[model samples]
Target: MGKEQEKEVILEQMEERAVEEISTHDAEKSIEEKLVAVQEEIAGYQDKMLRAAAEFDNYKKRMERDRNAAMKYAGEHILREILPVVDNLERALNQGVVSGVDAEMKLAALLEGVQLTLKSLLAVLEKFEVKAIESVGLPFDPNIQEALVMEPSDVVPASHVLGEFEKGYYYKDRLLRVAKVIVSSGKAAS
Candidate 1:
């Protein structure tokens, strides 16, 4: 009712409104700061996931390349071993044709060279798990021996191997070649 009282009442109401506005602004600022922190944490996790995926892809490609290289060179070692055998054979043939050597002496030297070369080849084969099969004086086996002819013999019993035209061979427990052989029929008629 009085002018001074009315003025005091208006000042108190304005002060209360200012206090409410300041409190609301502070609450809004705190919420904004929390949202920024959460967004940064999410970005860091995404970066780590991307890096892990790239590393896994690189590992798979490297393994595939190594496997292909291994397959390509699988038989390189075996071919290297056989090259020396071929060289030895070439030398033996060349020695057989040397001029001024006596015919008998040349023949003996050639034969010796061939025998040595054969021994060396056999050694190489053995190193790779290849072995010769013995057929002479044993019972004829159709599984491993091919009968070239039937012959009558007193020394070899019926159904036995008379002789081998070509020897059989085994490579790692499996038959590589069959023996070409003569099989005994029975004793000859008097």
Candidate 2:
């Protein structure tokens, strides 16, 4: 309507444009900052991925090593278990139990042959990494010792092994059979 009013209105419009320009510049800067943060996050994720891949490779190698070791000692347990039987047979022969005099001679010869056979068998087992589990006078371990019975004992502590009824064998660290044992029961815990 009036020239002065028009000029005032024009000045107000110019001021509004300046404010919008400032806001646009701020928005552009914010967008750039956000892009930088997103890039940083992506870089961090990539680093984590690389670490995971490295860990997986190490795990594979470790597993392979364990597998090979298990394979190497696979037969050890069975052989170890059979060792006690050989020992028992040898003991029987040493005791010299027989019937007739002629039969006794034959039996003695048979026992000697059996002893030699057992020795040979044990030697073969030894080559395969088979080992016997120690059961006598030791603690009763459920992992290696199977409790045949709990018996009262004065010499051994309760829960300890009093005697091994049958021997256990191990192939490497794996148990083939648990040793059958009698466990000692202590003085009724008073």
The superposed Cα distance between candidate 2 and the true structure at residue 44, in angstroms, equals 2.1
Which pairs in model 1 have colliding backbones? none
TM-score of each: 0.68, 0.46
lDDT values for all models: 0.92, 0.83
* Model 1 C-alpha lDDT per residue in residues 53-168, reported as the tens digit of each score: 99999999999899999899988988999888899988888888999999898888889888989999999999999899999889999999999999999999999999999999
Q: Which ten residues in a row have the lowest lDDT in candidate 1?
A: 16-25
